[model samples]
Target: MQTVSFLFFNIILPIFIPIIAGYLLQRKFPLNVATLTKIQFYIFIPALLFTTIYQTELNSALLRDLILANLVLFVLLWAVCLICARLMKLDAGKRSAFINSVCFYNSGNYCIPLIQLMYHTPFAFSIQIIVMLIQQLLTNTVGVMNTSSANRSWKGALLENFRMPMTYAVLIALLCRWLSIDVPKPLWTSFELMAQGLVPTALITLGAQLASTHLYLRNFRVLVSNAMRLLVGPLLAAAVCWMWGISGVVAQVMVICAAAPSAVNTVLLAIEYRSDPEFASQTVFLSTLLSALTMPVVIALVQYL
Candidate 1:
């Protein structure tokens, strides 16, 4: 109970308050969601990724585990999305949104902050960063193909994948690591400063995006989809972690990442793919709002497990 309280007050609350405030402010003074999202996708998130990877010590074991964990979770959620789409008899676009929403968890913005707060160690945070990178790559590459409405060309999708800043950052980081190139202190400091803005800006932008959406309080499909995200997703991840003999902080981070509500990127994917962007946006909004409560409960339950 105390642990849950700490997570809520110390970690979750700090992250969310600014977001909620941003939402309110946005409502009062509207801004462009597309412009903000573009900034985040192109600049802030990638900068953060570069800084984190460049500074961290990497190991093959940790990298393999992170990749495996993300792959397993993505596959599981994709299956769930398919089942849900079938049951719902959704059209192609709606089905795509549903699958993207379920499969692309907010492993970066939400999970990283929560892990950093819970573990209070740079090493643990670095693990979360690596896992986030793996998830980002998978979602941007494979997940994009699954949701795209354009001609399904693997080569095109792969080409588009390189356009993402996160991918470029990872490539640079890997090269730097391989070559044992130490970043100059000034450059490292500049990157760190830029990276520091990623989380808060992301959360605030997310909040603003949510505020822009029209949430249907009585939408049963939306409610159930979010329930699957908050409950079933985490349970599946927990089971996998147990089966894989993962324990301690790694297991906790896995569970939390799984438990996170739909990523804001789901809406972006839906829009790009000519899917039901409205539904996708609503799901993202509601899930994020509800996560304020559900995340604490999930964390509390995991503490006992």
Candidate 2:
């Protein structure tokens, strides 16, 4: 079918090709994925976020609607994750990772690309980027607190989020937009160049991350978390869409954004916070692999909706 081919060639192939390239490079040379991730975290992601939000036509009314929709979806997903975590009787660290796995998603790398290819419009892409902003902010703040050591206070975790440059990048962009400040040509062009690398870098690093991780899991809880992420997540997103009276491209974009696999950043957080990186990595890997099959279904489903 044309739909299948379009999804494959346009969506899956673009991501997988970079991943395969990174995988081969890592296998041959054994890269320092952590250092690469640091580059992305400190420089690339911030640049991408700043450029996108600054240039996009994110008006106040649409912004308010998106904020509400994002808020409702996030709470629902967290609640769903908590219910699953309690039922599984998971321990503290693993429960934190499980809840994070279900809540945080690949909004940046996965959803943005699909949105661009599927609709090829700035409005649709910007909507997905706004969702990415919500996910990124939550992953930095709440995610940090959840994974933190007991001795580390929630205040410490909150401050730790401030250390992330991307957070400030977003704030500055928003301020610039509100103040009607413009990014001059040379700087804006450079920002655009940096933004261009985000997707390819993210996908390639994902491959390297996968290559570095030890991925043999016996725990069924991982599967449960993935189900919550890839299955329940979209349902919750759709519910929010309906609740907010969202339809057409915006609704489809929100639902597709929810269907993204666990955030690659979740693994980074687990490793940094001394949580169960093994479990985090395995969950992300499996969810991502499964999403290769599920994305097409969501894509088609969105069309009918």
Candidate 3:
């Protein structure tokens, strides 16, 4: 019971309150969610990534686990997306949104806070960071391709991937690790301060985006598609973790991260690729709203199992 309450107050409430509040404010003020999203994407997220990786102690085992966990989740999600696409008989644009809805989870923005609240360990936070990095890369590259038009070249996608701030940060971290270099204290402090802005700003921005979205509750197809994203997607992820013999805090992190709703990135990609951005945005907003219930339940179930 205490765990449940803790999860709510520490993990769930902190996330959802901002979303709800932002949505309400947006209804009144109608802020430009796109601008906020751009700020997060370009500045805040990169700062978070560089600082987290630069200061952390890295080793081969951790890297291997993080990579393997991401790979397993990605493959499972890809399979789910393909199957869902065929079953729904979706057109190309809708299919892209559907695929992305299933494939992309809100790992970086949403999961980071929850992991920190629950585990309260730098190592645990580091693992989540690594997992998110992998997720970010995959979502930008393969995820973009899956949702994009055929005319979209792999080269263009690769270039976009290379341009990601988090990618550069990871590269630097890797180099530092390889060279046994210590990150200077002043730089670390700066990174830390910048990184601190990531979670709240991200959550608020997500809320603002949700507020900006049109909630089509009557759109049963969209609802069902989102259900698959929020419900079935996490179940599939849990099964993969079990099969991989992932247990303890690591397993919990994987399950929780997997349980996050479709990323806002999906909506951005949908807009960029000329997919059904409305459907994509609506699905992401609704799934995130519903995840307040779903995530805690998923976590509880995993704990028992």
> Judged by lDDT, which candidate is best?
2
What would the per-residue lDDT of candidate 2 be over residues 38-65, giving only the tens digit for each residue? 8878888788778877877767887898
lDDT tens per residue, model 3, 150-242: 857778877877877777877887688779888888977887887788778777777777776777798665787678777877787678767
Ranking by lDDT: 2, 1, 3
Each prediction's TM-score versus the true structure = 0.90, 0.89, 0.90
- Mind giving the per-residue lDDT tens digits that candidate 1 earns over 21-60? 7799799999786787778777777777777677677688
lDDT winner between candidates 1 and 2: 2
Per-residue error (Å), model 1, residue 154: 1.9
In model 1, the runs with Cα more than 4 Å from the true position are: 149-152
Ordered by TM-score, highest first, the candidates read: 1, 3, 2
Error of 3 at 149 (Å): 3.4
| Span of ten consecutive residues with least summed lDDT in model 1 | 149-158
Clashing pairs counted in every model:
0, 0, 0
Q: Candidate 2: which stretches are off by over 4 Å? A: 272-274
TM-score of 1: 0.90
